[model samples]
Target chain A: MFYGYFNGTIAPTDQLAVGITDLGLLRGYGLFDYFLTYNGRPFQWDWYWARFQNSASRMHLKLPLGKDETYAIVMKLVERSNEAISKTGKATPTDVGIRFVLTGGYSADSISVEKPNLLILAEMIHPVPAIQYEQGIKVILDEYVREMAEVKSTDYKRVILMAEAIRAARASDILYQKGGEISELSRSNFFIVKGEKISTPDRHILHGITRKTVMQLAQSDFQVEERPVLLSELYDADEAFTTSSTKKILPITQIGELTIGDGHVGPKSKFLLERFDELVKTW
Target chain B: MFYGYFNGTIAPTDQLAVGITDLGLLRGYGLFDYFLTYNGRPFQWDWYWARFQNSASRMHLKLPLGKDETYAIVMKLVERSNEAISKTGKATPTDVGIRFVLTGGYSADSISVEKPNLLILAEMIHPVPAIQYEQGIKVILDEYVREMAEVKSTDYKRVILMAEAIRAARASDILYQKGGEISELSRSNFFIVKGEKISTPDRHILHGITRKTVMQLAQSDFQVEERPVLLSELYDADEAFTTSSTKKILPITQIGELTIGDGHVGPKSKFLLERFDELVKTW
Candidate 1:
């Protein structure tokens, strides 16, 4: 069972709704942030909150609640969701996903929204299967650019429109490139590791919280570089990976037809993944 | 008393709602089309429908209703709205605004939506005040680019985020520019009038229905050129204006500190506005 915090009230996910006139629905003017919970506690909560606040500021959306208030609401929703799931004769989920959404509230004019509506949703976490980690995933290069690339806004039109192509290619996700410069993936940040160096694009991409942590962890052991990653560079990289909230470090073995580092999960990627898992426990 | 046609049911606008998990609300994955009604009859319904179909196709959203079916539903809503206003002891509005929205429907996963929710809203047309036309309007140039520039998706983040800057500048709307090339305004298409010639950006912009009509009308009497309009070109143009469904042809007398066409409405703009009004009557 899913639980949701709508505005200021906690309720079942089914009861959470927004008016059709909400700018988030009518104009797609909204911001969202999602992070995972481990052992019923939010992982990297402060970093997620800072990113959430930045996204709201970039989109000019006034979040209805402060970070602490939002944290309380999320904790309550998670508790309620676990209770509801237990009532269904199921064990409580060890981990769950939390999504905070802020939308330009109901509008009669359909142009401007003043009072923003906030929704917090909690659901069972679906982890990437071990098989994907054992055998790294393949990705395809697509020529597309996201709008408001900095803010985590609700305009995923480019990716959604390319859903068919991504599925037909049998690729896990797309590596977006504009003018031959690689940006990021549809839902994750791209990284390339060459020998003792790690690099990722620092501009025209959503700066993921996990990406920051990965960079910090990588800097401790390797030379980390944050700069533009071109499509041509990925073909020659010794190893490649993606970072996201749910998928900490996913190895990318192939880009289109070219394989990276013998087309297997490299030692660097494996080491980083292991380190990420170990670090998550400390949080 | 506002009326709305939601999915297949005609109900009060207050009853219109969408689930929080709807992809349209979550991912801003939706498309919309709006046109005006004159004397209780939709103006250029065919053009609006064609554009609506094109937008939906570009966004990969399957509209639930066909042209004829949608027309029938819109006519009913308009009639009901007129009746509601009349029953309130107010004069029946001669003009009304009709909006048709197609949203990626409720999704449990919030990533993919196969079913779509349809909404048809009819409201009394809010005409631009006469003073805006008489005194003309001032606009400012903004450095922003819209994503999926051709598709009319529901993502207006750039405009909303810049709302404060626009108001502080005392400008009516924003004229978006990228790399010195003038694209369009926040909600309208930009056109520059050089004596005996009219030009507007033909690419990387939403192809407005009213803009097409204006081009057709201008072609009958003037040399119409549809090409890229640059910021430098606008500073030297004799006159400028914008076109949309509601605000037919609004003269732009100033762009920042540059006064367009002697800082007053040009004769050509006046003539075009008059011609547009006359053409509307025959519709």
Candidate 2:
């Protein structure tokens, strides 16, 4: 019972569509933010909404609904999804993921900016396997940075084109490097732990909500540095990991052929993941 | 009158839509090519199709239909557009512009590759105003290079976000510069004319079909050089112009604040425009 909200109406995901003239489809001019619900409630809703607003503002787009209305719609979809599970005789309903897309809208000239199209998609959440999280995942490095890296634009052609290579390498994701600096992962923010200090690139990366939460969780116990993390520093790091809405603080045990710090989940990464889990469980 | 073909069905442009799960709309994983008709027939159809094929290959997308079937679908939309114009009581039917879009199909995971969705959009050709070509157009410079510059991926967020600045500068398009080299315009290929020499940047840009046609048209009389065009060279050039499917050989008189060769359309640009007109008239 996956549902979606298109404009003002809520409907089944399969029935939602955008017109052909939409710039999101025609020119790929749009922004999107994804986050999963925790215990049937949107986790970090304010943070996600703020980031979505920032993305829209940077892209010069207008929001179709206020924060309250958007939350209402998400709740409606969540209720519908859980109701379907209840009808299935399931005792415990799982969480869901919500995505907000704001497009440049329908243009008659195909170039002009008109009223924007807004779409919200909700799907059943699928968690990463516990073994992968316990053992950590591997990532391949790519020498590229996303254009307009600060904005959460819906342009992922670079990583999408790297699908074959990623699969061939048996990697989970691509860690983007540009000009000797490691910026971020394809879909998340990256961090490295050296001794008692934690560092991540502050520029040329999306400021992930999960990343922020993890930083706060470790602020009292470890030093947090949010500057440009150089590619050279990856070799000296004792532990590394990525953070996103879905993969909350999954360790990265390997990159390319280099095994990160003995090729096993480091104690620092496990500590941060434990803190993240504790924080989210309360939410 | 406008019509479009989606998958195997042809309908009015307004009635066409793509599913919400499409990667083209969700992640902007797609490629597109646009060309206009010459005398009710596709101008440079073979060249356009070849380039489209290259773009798809570079982007790792599969064409949904073979060449013959694609051509058939395009003709179907063209005929539908013309038929609608005939009902409007117009005696002289105008040529139409066809845009072929191939998107990463509906991905269940929103990350994996799937069968592509093909959409063909046909609209009545809207040629650039006669005066703009006579007086030439102005373009602003942006310091960025598109990722996967060789592929015609549907990522135009940079230029789309530049809409207000472009309008404020009264510029029709953006000229991309990277590492002191002038690459191409946001939607066209650029060239500078110096005396009898014609030069255009051959890398980090979309290889425009019209740009190729103009080079061939001028080869018999003018010296053509395809190489890295330096940003410094724009000031010394006698004339400049941009070529694309819609704006075929339109003169460019001003870039940023600098005037090109006395700030008016130069003789060389006029000559090439005349040649292009002559070549397209026969088709």
Please report the candidate that would top lDDT against the real structure.
2
Off by over 4 Å in 2: A88-94, B91-94
Please report how far candidate 1 places residue A134 from its true position, in Å.
1.6
User: Tens-digit lDDT track for model 2 on A1-283?
Assistant: 7789998888888899899888998899988999998877899999999999999998889998999999999999888877776787876465889999999999888888889999998886667889888899999999998878889999888788899999999998999998889999999999999999999899989989999999889999999999999878878899999998889999999999888888899999988888888877878
lDDT of every model, 2 decimals: 0.87, 0.90
Candidate 1 is graded, for docking, as medium
Q: Which lDDT tens digits does candidate 1 get at residues A1-283?
A: 8899887888898987788789898998888989998777898899999998998877777778888998888888888888888899998785789998888888777887679888899976778889889889989888877766878888777677788887998988888999999889998999999989999998889999999999998888999999988888876799999999888999999898889988989999999999999988866
TM-score quality measure for candidate 2? 0.97
lDDT of 2: 0.90
For residues B1-283, write the lDDT of model 1, one tens digit per residue.
7789887889888887788888889998888888998777899999999988998888778888888999998888888988888899998886689988888888776777679888899876778888888878998888887777777778787777778887898988899999999899988999999878899998789998899999998988999999988888876799899999888999999898888978888888889999999988877
lDDT score for candidate 1 against the true structure: 0.87
DockQ of each: 0.71, 0.79
Q: TM-scores, in order shown?
A: 0.96, 0.97
lDDT, model 2, position B211 = 92
